[model samples]
Target: MFKKFSPSTDISGQTPVKSSMQRAIRSSILSSWNIDAETLEAIWPKKESIIHVKCREHISIYTLHNEPLFFQHFDGPVYPTLRLLHKYPFILPHVGIDRGAIRFLLAGANMMCPGLTSKGGRLPPQDAALPAGTPVAIDAEGKEFAVGIGLTTIGTEEMKKINKDVAVESVTYVGDELWAVQKL
Candidate 1:
């Protein structure tokens, strides 16, 4: 995966986030990721300065102290920042994949059912109950690092019934343009 990630050249201008926008961001994060308000407040203190950049046509990336924290898509829910993933590893619903799948994921491939059903891969117990299109963190099995974010294509029960089809569509993963853009 690391081999496939070339640094991005796209430049995005930063703008100070307003108080009303901050409140909306906080609310969206809480509802989308199921995090409590207090924890969200603690992670994003009111006094600290935060800014946002339009990284893509529809996506705006939020940063605090020059570190990317989260991003919001105009038509979708908020997405966890890779930085936040390291700080709060289990905050979002997740699927575990073996090391073999990491490279492909970083290369922008969708996750197949076997990656979640293989000996080294596993799905969260509650994932079977989640609706399609729910955001899910993708973590490596033994390393326990978040490698990607995806949206489930089907409910967990359906995922289990199939063996070779795509289970989750990759939205962003480590080493992709979103991650590389932060380095710019």
Candidate 2:
């Protein structure tokens, strides 16, 4: 399920997002991740401004104090940035993968089912009931770091039955443009 990805060069239209819009975004994060309002407040203090960045036709990125926080897709849920993942890995559901699959995922490959069902992989029992398209963090075996965020292609029961197919579609990873965009 991996595809070759080329980075984008356009940064043409960026402006400060409104407070009203920021509130909606905050609400979306709270409800989607099951996080409390206080936690959200702490992560995103009132002093920081949330910027709306249009990277392309359907891709919009939100940044807090100039650090990328989420990428909103026109047709999907907003995905937390890798910076957010590194700071708060437990904030999202997790899917563990074997060490061998780490390189592929970093290269923007969609996570294969076998990687999650293999010997070194483990999926939490609580995540078994989560619906497809739920955002999740990816962790490699024996590593304390989260590699990226992905959308589930199937629920756990179906995932357990399959040996080959795309399990998680990579939205953003360590080396993707979303990650690199942070430095600019």
User: What local distance difference test score does each model get?
Assistant: 0.76, 0.78
| Candidate 1 off by > 4 Å | 1-9, 126-128, 181-184
> Top model by TM-score, which number?
2
lDDT of 1 at 82: 70
- Per-residue lDDT of model 1, residues 45-127, tens digit only: 87886887665456677788777788766768678767577678767887888778888887899999888878778786753
Q: Candidate 2: where are CA atoms >4 Å away? A: 1-8, 126-128
The total of clashing pairs for model 2 equals 0
Error of 1 at 41 (Å): 2.0
TM-score of each: 0.84, 0.89
After TM-score superposition, the amount by which residue 30's alpha carbon in candidate 1 deviates from its true location, in angstroms, is 1.1
